[model samples]
Target: MDPVIVVGAGPVGLTLSLALAAQGVPSVLLDEGPGTEEPRPARTVVLREDSADLMGRLGCRELDRVGLRWSGWRSIRRKQLVRNVPLSGGGGAEDDTALTGLLPAPLHVPQHELSAALRAAVDKAPLVQRVPLSRIDTLEQDPDGITVHTREPGSTWWRGSYLVGCDGARSTVRKLLDIRFPGRTAVERHAVAALRAELPWPDEAVLHRQPPWRTGGAEVSARPLPNGVWRLDWLLPPRGELVTPEALITRIRDTLAGWCGETPAYELLDTGVHTLHHRLARRWRKQRAFLAGDAAHLLGAVGTQGLDEGIRDAENLAWKLAHVWHHGPAEHLLDSYQAERRAAVAARLRAADQSLPILRGGGGLRTLVPGAARGHDTLLSDGHLGCGALGAPPSYSHSPLAPPHTEAHAAVGTPPGAPVADVTVTAPDGTTTRLRERLGQGHPLVVLVAPGTGVWDRRHWQTAGVMPRLTDAVAALPGSTELLVTESYPGASAHTVLLVRPDGHLVAAFGGVRPAELFTAARTALGGAPHEAREPVEPGDGESGGDGDGPDTGRGQGSRARVHADGSAGLH
Candidate 1:
């Protein structure tokens, strides 16, 4: 088995490698790191709630330790408050209801800090072979694998079953594939700074939008970092404005002063200027090589979704590869990654288009006044500081992977393709636990047994009884796990069986059914091989079944590729 080759060492590449490693897949991580000490602006990235959950699931627990959690951003016009879009719906304070929910609140972290955490995870995982200072020279794909040629002091070649390009906006992989990235660019440049200062204002983040009345004004936003510094990004005047160090300093001071009555003395840590754009790749995949992160799309600063969306692309692609390798599922399974993620990013781009002008021009300042009407709602809906824009989880109802809702499984309100809400489940022994704690992770189809289903005794199944009929039904499929619990969520009926994919989305659910029939239905919904449904076994007559097999830990078992870290191919 060949390793999956990952290009680029940014957060997305590091994240993709680590996610695959956790699932027992190995990868070769290639990056041309610090070729030169070119100065770069201090940029901060915000992770939506779902993005935070993806990080937590991938074992990047250092985020909360090194990142600041903010409820939302305060939108202000000149010196007056226009509106406050609270992402969590509570005041600026941390909401306990949100903190205790399935996902954590949004986070603000310096780009470097986020990269460092992901790199640390990569360093710790043995399955991830990190080849720093290596750059991709060329790539060619054969029918079964891809050959990647890299250049450093000494050029070398490597092989992989799949190659994922997580390189930045000017992605070499995308260029090699000749996939056009089409979109509009903003001629205006933006200045971003990382600075430290003491302020007498609420800890929440703030975005100051200059009303259209101020023709030559720039929009500025500042957010607190866990490291005691603040990240400030403001639009710079068009090219001929003649920007100077003093002018930049004055701009920062003025922006800060407007938010916090007075600007105290401050130390500038870093600063840089760059242009932003709104672009998407014509295609994210070409044969065996694929694109993720900034390589796939660039939403620019208008929408702080570039990093989060890239992280999501990695999350969506990793599990499918794992499933294919581990279960020998149809290769078509891999196609869903593009189908689902591309649509999601398209929606995000549309939302960004509607809100970018509002952010830069304050086009909706009047509508944000107290008791404003719904006409301006789109302007404040899904931008950098908008409530609806955070994490914008996608619904794959139109995805081929989602089974259509049918009369057979109507009671479960969770429509096909919608993300499954984490529900608290009560055990027969009174032990309580959340579904997400077990549903996600491992690549497998989860069998959730709802309570009151006369199909089996709740206590008996919980303690450890197996229904032989259920075992025989899924025996042919590999890389699958099962869970038994009394229904705690409202949707589960007396006897319910929910077949969920490894990503935690419901594939199908059946109520008041027998084990064989439920298992057969689940297989069919999953598009697996056909299986004949059987009747429920008589008491003690069939093979006993407990929680189904745990995640596959053995090497080279699934249809997915197995990577070997032989170091036969070397890099600096």
Candidate 2:
């Protein structure tokens, strides 16, 4: 089969491959750098919960294994710790099945570590092809697919079906497509480095945004690293004097000399100076060619949104691309990928830019800025950032897979992209879990509501037996799938159960009344096969399933099938 080809080995590119790999999408990945991948300790870590789950889905659960689970944040001004806030609270609508709906708290793990773990995770993923140093040279795209020519500088050309440029800010794909990246370069260059040592972390990430360039711009933040290491970043204005790494390090030591000794025999792992610029690509896709991660958009350096946005870009596009590859969605559907994602990136850029004032110590407007402004400045970028708005259960107002809003949601289910109420999630294995558990597992959960309202009462569900059968199958299967059935979820009727993909998209929500109609519509919307030869629903936010409610509206539970059809199979 012709596979989707991704270029870049960075966190976004690698994690994108992992998301596709999880959904069984065959992909070829090319990264033109480094041999071994390991978390560089401190390097820009994505600071969002969705990013963690996306990384986890990419097979980087190793982060939780090696990285520290940091909580809350602390901000300092002139060495005085001022703002201190927690990332989440285990409160609200806590119940027997699950707990507090969700608080958008991010997890911290180095990009290097996340990338390495993703590569390792692909070991079981035959669809993901890793080609390090396999650089791209030529590219061609047509309606059918893409042809990507790659080489080793002056070597033979290797081709691929589709070309995805996740090649970072200086993406060859962007250069090749001649896509315009428009943005202003920051007045100062950002210097990043991590030191390994034991220091009192205050159990939080600390940030210090120095005053503006009047006295020469310089700002720093303190984020915890695994194994007692501390990650520090500096934003320095160019002094017209080319500064060496040694000189820069000496300056940092001078500024932080007090804490330097406390860190023990600290070893500096990696160091690099990058000229930070705020660039946004004119477009993200052309024909069968597309851009992902940093290739499509450049996030300003005011917040922790850069990598998170890239990962979201990958997850959002992967499933849509797979749907097109499998069932041939409308070409316009494919076009929407760039539109929706670019808009999201745009939102991040605006917020990050708006927050820059705080990083520049309010830029002579300290008293003028609202507390929310400064709060967002000091916290959102530096803390285990909360994205209750977009972090968990983010929806696509225009997802091609989602059915055209009937009455535009004239009124059922939570708002698209909205989080569900907090409740317990119980498994037959006797494990009672929390809301975050479903999202963090990296595997999608097919939630089957207990059944209510005549919304699912149509002929579509009953005639096809699609809804009931799938749930029953999932229930019988031991560990391959997780089936969440709840009767009393807050804000939802007893019979309303929602199917949540591991990536946090709402796949199929029931209880509107025309049971079968909903079943059929949902199955069709998500690219699920009919029950005639139905395969188990494939989670991972990829195409895919099922049944029932207790009502005259035509819903019922699945009778236990003594015979197992777990061996059933289907085609692409």
Candidate 3:
């Protein structure tokens, strides 16, 4: 089997590799070293709810079993506890409450912990081969496939069909492709320090933002980590002097010193000086090569959105690789990688670029008046904390991968960071369960929580309201299914049904249960045509009784594919 070479054993590469492996696709993964698990930088990364299912599917145990979740984050001032801004939604779409329930609180884990989890998960994937201490010296791609040459400080030879660049901001692959990276660097350097401490803060994540006293503007946000530790990050003025580990630590100690009278002992875990750079590669793909995560885009650290965005990139690209390698042409899909992602990065950087000034210290949540609307609340948005802007849904706007839409307003709500809410349901046993748990990864899913009455026949599901192309796709599915019941959200009048993809974001939705509407939705949910208005499956049988994925699913033998270390390529 020809292997796809994945550069960087970090989250993005490992994740895409795992997705491919899960589906029997294989590939090889290369990284500079085991990559230290030192938990160094001391940065806290919040994994958006949307990326959770994808990561869990990749087999990260922290995502599956041990990660910490915060229902939402609370904002605070020097003295007062401001508003508690909800992070993830309450499970907005009405699908199986099972999957929706999983959309509960957002997960907050350290970058290292996350790395450790990805490392473990990838090790178990049969199709993934982990090659540590190895680096790619050069890459050359042609009509047939790609040839990757890898070496360590010392080394040998290896070949592959494709390469996914997950290297950091200074990406060698991006350079190899000659993709230009255009963006600016923040003039104000930041001091980020992680130290063990006991602060008077909530167990949930806290961002105590403040305006820079001298600058009359910039702001700083301090986050608490898992152990009895905390991270203090603040913007320094253009003329601000340089600071070492001790000096930065002392400054933090003195600043928060008065607040916490009995200063808890703080041992500096790690400290670093980094200037935030906002840039996106000129392109994301060239021939058989692709870039994801930090390798593709870099945004100032305003909302801790970098990692989650990368994880989403992997999931999106993984399936595209799977489908093309297993069934169609590869070139047809590569263009979409840049078309879809470049726009996303541009938008994120724009927002980050705008918000950076507020950090140098004036407006924004950092300047919210204490007694004033501590938080300006509205029914439509979540935090408005610049997060909503970055959490902006992903778009396949210019890509052929997404079917063309005729609607005047092309709705794009299913991308990586869109937030969702939760709902209740009448389970198979006539009991209630949540939607989150039901959001199993890998399966193209249709979640129908809206209550509909007419016996949904195939035609009812077809022309009633389904979008032409989407309906066709769903209808052709092997056993595309739906979950039906009453209200997904309490007190909400109209029943909203959303067609969700394998990951937990909405693909299509309609608020009413109009007969014609329900049919269109079912067809849309199924991806189209056959009008599969099949009777709903009984409780506990989420699995469609295909040739057999049941009590006896594997059949006479397990179907398998020959895969390399990086999860790419499949040989039947």
Q: Write the per-residue lDDT of candidate 2 for residues 1-572, one digit (tens) a residue.
A: 47888888777777667777656668888778754664455465754655665565455666766565555576655545567655452111112322433244456667666666766886567878787677788887765667776675535444555668899888999999989988766634667777765555544676665533232135676677656666776766644456687876764565455444322456787776756566789989887778987788765465545677787788777766665555544465467678768876676566556655554554565656667446654444442354433233345555544544443132234554444444454443334455445553333454544433224433433323234444443443312335554434555653344655444666555553233434444443444433422334432231123233333111222222122235442211
Candidate 1 lDDT trough over 10 residues, lowest sum: 552-561
* Candidate 1 residue pairs in clash (backbone atoms < 3 Å): 325-558, 325-559, 325-560, 326-558, 451-487, 452-494, 453-494, 453-495, 466-545
Q: Which stretches of candidate 2 lie over 4 Å from their true place?
A: 37-39, 88-105, 152-161, 210-218, 238-251, 254-267, 357-384, 388-395, 398-414, 418-446, 451-484, 487-490, 499-502, 507-513, 516-572
Candidate-wise lDDT, in order: 0.63, 0.57, 0.55
What is the alpha-carbon lDDT of model 1 when measured against the actual structure?
A: 0.63
**Arranged by lDDT, best first:** 1, 2, 3
Once fitted onto the true fold, the runs of candidate 3 whose alpha carbons sit more than 4 angstroms away are: 63-67, 77-82, 86-104, 152-154, 211-218, 358-386, 392-400, 404-443, 450-475, 478-498, 509-572
Give TM-scores for every candidate, taking all chains together and pairing residue i with residue i. 0.79, 0.74, 0.72
Judge candidate 3 at residue 432 and give its lDDT: 48
Q: How does residue 64 of candidate 3 score in lDDT?
A: 28
* Window of ten residues with lowest summed lDDT in model 2: 552-561
**Model 1 Cα lDDT, one tens digit per residue, 1-572:** 78899999898998899888877789999987852223332777778766766777777778777777765556665567766645552222444332454223468776777787787778889999988788898999998889989886648998998999998988999999899999977635777788887754344677666623322255667777754578777777545465678877877777656555567778899987767777989898888889999899987545456788898788778877766555554555677788888988887787777655544454356655765433333354344542454335666777756544555564565766665656654422345555554434554444444443334334344333233333333333333444434343445654455666666667767653234544454544344433332333433443233343331111111112111234121111
In the range 173-274, model 3's lDDT, one tens digit per residue, is 888888888877664467777777776664455655453232212445555555556666666665566776667756676646644664467677877776
